[model samples]
Target: MRKIWDIHGGIHPEENKHQSTGTAIGSIPLPPEIILPLNQHIGAPAEACVSVGDKVLKGQLVAKAQGLFSAGIHASTSGEVIAIEDRVVTHPSGMSAQCIIIKPDGEDRWTQLDACEDYAQLDHDRLVQKIRAAGIVGMGGAGFPTAIKVNPKSNKHVKTLIFNGTECEPYITADDMLMRERADDIVKGVQLIARFMGEVEETLIGIEDNKPEAIAAMQKAAEGTDIEVVVFPTKYPSGGEKQLIQILTGKEVPSGGLPADIGIVVQNVGTALAAYRAVRFGEPLISRVTTVVGETLTTQRNIDVLIGTPLSFVLEQHGFKAEKKQRLIIGGPMMGFAANDFDVPVVKTTNCILAPTQKELPLAPPAQACIRCGMCAEACPASLLPQQLFWYSQAEDHDRLKAHNLFDCIECGACSYVCPSNIPLVQYYRASKGAIKIANAEREKSDKARVRFEFRQERIAKAEAEKEAKRLARKKAAEEAKKLLAEKADSPAAANEKTTSKPGAAAAKPQAADPATQKAKLERALSSAQSRVERAQKALNDEQEEADEARLDSLRARLKQAELKASEAQAKLDEFGKAPEVTVGGEQAIKDKMAMSPRDKLEKNLASLNKRLSTAQERLAEAQANGAATVDALKMGVEKLQQKVNDAEQELAQLGPDSAAQGAAETAPALSAAEQAIEKAKAKAAAQASMSEEEKAAAKLEALKARLEKARARLTKAEEEQDENIDAFRAGVEKLEQKLTELSN
Candidate 1:
């Protein structure tokens, strides 16, 4: 006999478990359809791997775990995925959730499985993955992913691995019958879990003394090993993870903490068997032994029910009667919720299909005012004052509810079971807990919003300060320029001094030319200025299309500068009015200079063609080197430019130009560099969209390297006090480096 520690509060409910334990475990026939909910466990829903109308073999993965806390889901039998849509699921909220519906083929075929006799030789990570792949969860009640549960935090080492075989809930014998039939498998799973935990010191199996057969079976199976089967007295709600831990180890798990926090890990016996099948036989959790017991059913026994089987079908198999006002509970009466609709399918957390008649388990009388009785408090397993919590919960006094440790209540219904007023105490606590959780989440969101707003304000303030500093600096520069101009204007000697102080100013001065030559140069410069102004006006006045404002402005500015130079030249020539004959000859000279020979025109055109060809060739090479999609277009552009260059050279030769002048011939239309860059970008995007995974990864790696270099430059600048937000800049550098390392690995 093992010493069983007494918990704070408990009740001795009628043990109706024997009704379902008299016979051997039965097998369930395949239902017409199964509805597998994506979120059968306690975390994020698993992602569906199969689509509608796909044929899937039994035990094939239908959905994969979404994240670290989710479990995989496999098909219960060979079937076609008829639909993937929202359906009724086993949740207390009575809401429809995403589920996969399958139509069985009656073949009972299985997918290829990989069994391992040498699982112990596998590394720890491999074992965890195997368990996760098998979809093992805490079958006792919580339905937490077992793989994550078995893995304690890095700082904590598992010492005691307790198997909860104490099926203390009323009218639930699923675990008991499972132990009696498959004790060896359960024991093997226990050993596997210990091995996974790096050799847990104590492997204890806790079973109620009322389950003599189960205890004996486990003890026999665990023989010749270090596993211990601890038998204690039968007590209602004794199978809770925390309660069992205290009973077996005389240690209490701190409030709102896990047994793992105290170096103890608990796994339900059914979960252990599932782990055994997964590790040894490579069978996933496609089926479970569910206890179907109630007066509404003709048969009351445990059956190996396939997961996702409809509750109505299972009840019909047991000769269920359809009544207008019948109760169908999904678990033990104490902690189970009423299922008004029978369309919901069985899920991983379902332990019992209890359909007790109103007579077998009658409804409680309506509640009366509390007489300030301490009876509810005395029955609270967590030692909480239920009366206080209930009043505060109704009043919506969340602070008082939390102060009274309302979250620690497991809602086992022990208080309601013994309540004289028949108050639904558990319901109040559940609602209060939900309210508190919502309030806390809203508070967290508000805090995050506040931080973002403050950060944005700070950024705005910094930007305004920088803008003001730049404005002040520009004003100071203008003031200094104005001061120099005023000093020169105040004195003629100061202006002369400034000019003489300039480097090479005296050396750059030129002697005056003869009057004939000077007059000719001035007239030629004036003609050139007039030609520029006419060209600028023609470009601006073109009506075939909209003129570019920036281009027109640039031309106008150039024409103004040319006119200013021509005016200065004319002024210098006016000083030599003694040359009247030169003025008449200068007009003829202007016409001769403006009209170029055909060979000269051809040479100039060829030079432009060569420049375009060279630019196109450079672009093509760059595109090819970067593996850009613009390669083909750039290559075509280069070929076209090259052909133009060749044609220009031939034309120059035809014009009777010398061989040395054949390089220039005809002008070619060319795309601006900005337009070329835009095309390159579009082509690159198209190429990236068509790339394979590996190619995409390579491109991403290159991009990350470039970004990393930029980040490093920014970090260096920040270090040199060139910018603020040094911490953010440093973090960006580190983040880029981390991404690079991951990609490299």
Candidate 2:
């Protein structure tokens, strides 16, 4: 049944496993200086918690975890930090990442790590916390956070736990040695994780049929336990999570579904050892056993190395002649990236560093055009139409590539191996995948900006509607007031009554007589002007705050320097033979080695600092000169603000006691001014209507939509072509899929 269940499509190239598997893993002596990368794991690189000159103890976390996905970085040896800057990292891209360089102080001091024999007694969350705090991460090639993966999501109801011991990739033996040496520890760790996974109905440790010794050792360890040891056929990528699960349980982890979705969880054997060390010894995953081997090396053996230790160091230790090796790789030939720079540090996921000579791993020559051979389609493990993907990618048809499931290509290099043209198919696929990801990110950013734009547009429309409603209400109120006044005067009864009642008074003597009412109008005007002045003052305060924050960075740097100087003086007096300065001023002398020359006092001061960093060391005389100039600038700015405040106060004081009445009288004129201002604002808004950013975007979108319609029509016409060629293509596809399936099986 399992034989029948093996999914089709793969290539079986020469298995070059003997180059590095002969010897067991042994620890390497630590180098005088170790450069530890903060971002050794898969997630967000850990943030640097310590500075360039801080003294760190072994096992102490030098860099704290940046996020839930990030892992903490521990010091491999008690050392003074030499530098924290860009260095060669273990990335396949060979780019520089942040690294913490530590110079061992010869003490080999430890931070007193916590160990527990009764680790199982601890609460599950506490165990996960301990794992995280200890900086434990997956030692498998994946380098995912181990604590994150240990849990079998309850929603998925994981029923089977598969311990993946299938080190099927040729020329790597890190996991195989670990299993052979510490089967019991791995078994224990497996049980610990199994408990975390809740009820595990079945636990299977799947090792390849080739390693009978490893299988025997694990089987012995699982004697009384429910853990089952299963042997699988020797096949390339049989160790892949999906392929392994299928081999053992005949369960497929549907196209996008994880192991948990199929009630199964798979973990690497190397990860099992890491789990044991972390849980039993309370040790973080600082070092991992890496297979450094190939025919070009002076010696081939697995070395246990600290994460972020440079590959050059490992090669030098093994007597490898770097110049002689034609090719260097970070993992198996099937899946690893080429290493042009040997200085790349060992990352958490780095399992093997293969230094192969031309004879061992020969480079293929330039490729010619495909002869419609269909061999690549036959070799694809994902059962994808590699030929179709190649066509889309070649034509730069991103949409077509996506339709062909370009993302599903895991970049195993099987297609490249089988192609007669010797094309670097995987490189093309990788470039396409990278392009697609970047496009996706750009689309997401554009979507966010569009959402913000839409919100702004909606708010503007709402505010305009409200403003129009307010204007109509004011117009209606004014009309009503005028109507009431007209009715009172026009009524015959009102006129007759008023005339009859005015017998005592002269006909021309009708007038208003209240001085206080006039005074009230002037005060209201003064208050409005005062409010405007206050608004101006608040704006000035905001600008001042911005100025202060901008100065904060330089101020903080000075503060750090001062603190280091004070600590240095104390350290010198406390000890007879004082420690050598780790920093000179605040700069790390990574590029310079100290010797022969008479060290200046500033250099001595810089050496003793803990995280004391400096941009550039300027002479004291220059600093004094700069200080004097800065003082003058500050004086001028103060004088300017004071003058402005004084002018504002004087303007307010000029308005006398009759200011209130004067302001009241000016209210009618103020209303007229406000009406004029509103008219100007409305005219400006009308003028901007066609020139607004929203208007421009709308036009662009319309143009794009038209182009899209045209493209869609062309695509439809192209698709109709399939009917003519499809029968032959389908037959070609079936034959190709069959060949690939045959090779895979």
Candidate 3:
């Protein structure tokens, strides 16, 4: 014997279910067209598979499940897909959603189905997959996918499975009639679910004692099975998922938790029958038994209506009187919503369509302010403080609303129905819930952005630290090398001193006076002078200060210093070093080394002149393109570079042809990088002079396009960095783009 548990609060409204339950379940004929919504379930919307003008059969898949939580949609009857577009759907919002419309061919044909007579022999996963493929969902108005509800977490075990035949809503007799007429199929569905569950200790069916016929029918079907039909006292909302679980198992599901969390799984009687037909007979959920009852219906009864059939068609077939109907409600009167658009099609969750007159279901009076009433709290089944929630929600105090457990409200309309002050408490709670969800989503996005910003800052700091460490190491190495060089210059060192107490006469030569040492000193001096010249030129070109005569003077002085250092080194070699004039071959070597110095100086000057000329040409081109005022300054720079180049050539020519033969032997082995660059530039100039006009134009166009692309890339980077020179880069890009466009045309 199972003990029935009591809930916190409930109301006993008039159960006008007899008007629909009196007759046997009837079948409605097919309408001219059916409109099926893709988002019939609670998760992601299903994806449509059929296009307009495609032929389809009854039970054929028209829309496939989009995700794990969604269910598939199938054709209710054989037809041609006439439209796939947004249309009115069965929702409280009365909005249009994606739908597939079909025009029936009257054949009522079905596609091939894979049925399993002995489902118990199949694997559990296979059975679940079969149910999912059949497009079965919770028909109990929740519309949650049934495959998801049945399969609990691996760690959680279901001890009892409850079939809710209570049908406690007022004026809704679909489930009750189903239990009375199809009890054997319902029982078979129960056994099938139990087998899928694997370890259920008890399988129970709960129905209100008001429907004796339903209880007797279910009991007779479960004579030899493990199913038990338990009849309890009739209550208004005893059919709620949580309330039914509490009534049968004597366990209160924790707030914001499901019944499966408490080792229980509940399914509506209609859902179970659908599952049975899906697995045993291979019929997809294309139709359901809907109760058509109210004052406006000439015939009040249950009819097996096809899914996606328009409500207008069903009501019209039942002798619906439009003039007498005051409200068109879907579902029971207590929890149903009023329908404003009659073309809205019935979905998987729809069970009842009530066309009641104004007297049968009167409109609620205008809501007045709360008068400190406790009736709402007394009527709440979830034990929530309704008045406080209403106050906080109206005040927009979200934190207080959360603290009062606003989400725990089932929105069953029990509170508003029992409110003496007539305050619409449920409406206020719904608004608050929407606000809370939006707030949570925005907060989550902000947190993710903050995390990304912090990560980027950390990376930059790490890179800067690594660069600083490398800089310090290089400074230390340079200082150590300088110290070692100074030590060698200050004191004479002998290699034999470490082996003997006294140094040999040959080892008495000072390390600083060695020929190699002198050569190294001269090389270092030249390299330092060349580096200074490069730095001065770079500063002048980068800053674009053509009037900086002081900078030009400084560059000239540095070049003179380099020349003086070369001369002093040559004089030193002539005085202290062995004379190359001693041998017959030595005379030629002496002349070669002497000529090498002047050649190197001229080569360095020529390279600098070439670089200045290139810089001047670039500035001149920009000034011409932008109509700037700096053309004269740039043209003067270009003329000075040309003159310097001419002078260098003259000097090279003045040195006789013998000088080249004389210096080639010695300078070839010791040519500096600058001297090598001068040779390459000379070769390229000779080649350019030999090219045809057409070839030159093509090459020039290619170069301009390359430059434009590079400039555009720099401009983009500068914009992102908010650089101060962004305008400069943008101007350069535009100029290059214009030049390329002209050349292309």
Q: Which candidate number would show the highest TM-score if scored against the true structure?
A: 1
Lowest lDDT 10-mer window, candidate 1?
Answer: 661-670
537-576: candidate 1 lDDT, tens digit per residue? 4444542145577776666555555444544444345434
A best-first ranking of the candidates according to their TM-score comes to 1, 2, 3
lDDT of each: 0.83, 0.72, 0.83
Which lDDT tens digits does candidate 2 get at residues 1-745?
1242465576566776666667777777777678888778778999888988899988888888988888898988888999998987776677888899988888878888788899879888877877788777766677778777775455878889988998878888888877878899899889888887787899888888888778888989999998888886687777777877878888777675677887888888777777778888888777888888887788887888877677888888888886778888999888898888877777778899888889888889999998889888877767888888888888889999988878777787888888899988888888888888899999999999999779767866875676576557656655765576688668997689777775667575343322333233333333333333333333344344444765554454343333333333322333322324333442334222221121232234334331122211222234456773223223323343454445444444454344554555444333334565797799877866857787755665565555555445444544574333345555554555554455435
Query: Where is model 2 poorest over a 10-residue stretch in terms of lDDT?
Result: 610-619
User: Candidate 3, residues 280-384: lDDT per residue as tens digits?
Assistant: 888999999999999898999999999999999999999999999988999987788889999899889999999999888888899998998789889888889
Alpha-carbon deviation at 433 in model 3, angstroms = 2.1
Clashes of each: 2, 15, 0
- TM-score, every prediction: 0.69, 0.67, 0.67
After the best TM-score superposition of candidate 3, give how far the Cα of residue 385 lies from its true spot, in angstroms: 2.3
- Predictions: Cα RMSD each: 20.4, 29.9, 14.5
TM-score of model 3 relative to the true fold? 0.67
Q: Which stretches of candidate 1 lie over 4 Å from their true place?
A: 452-745
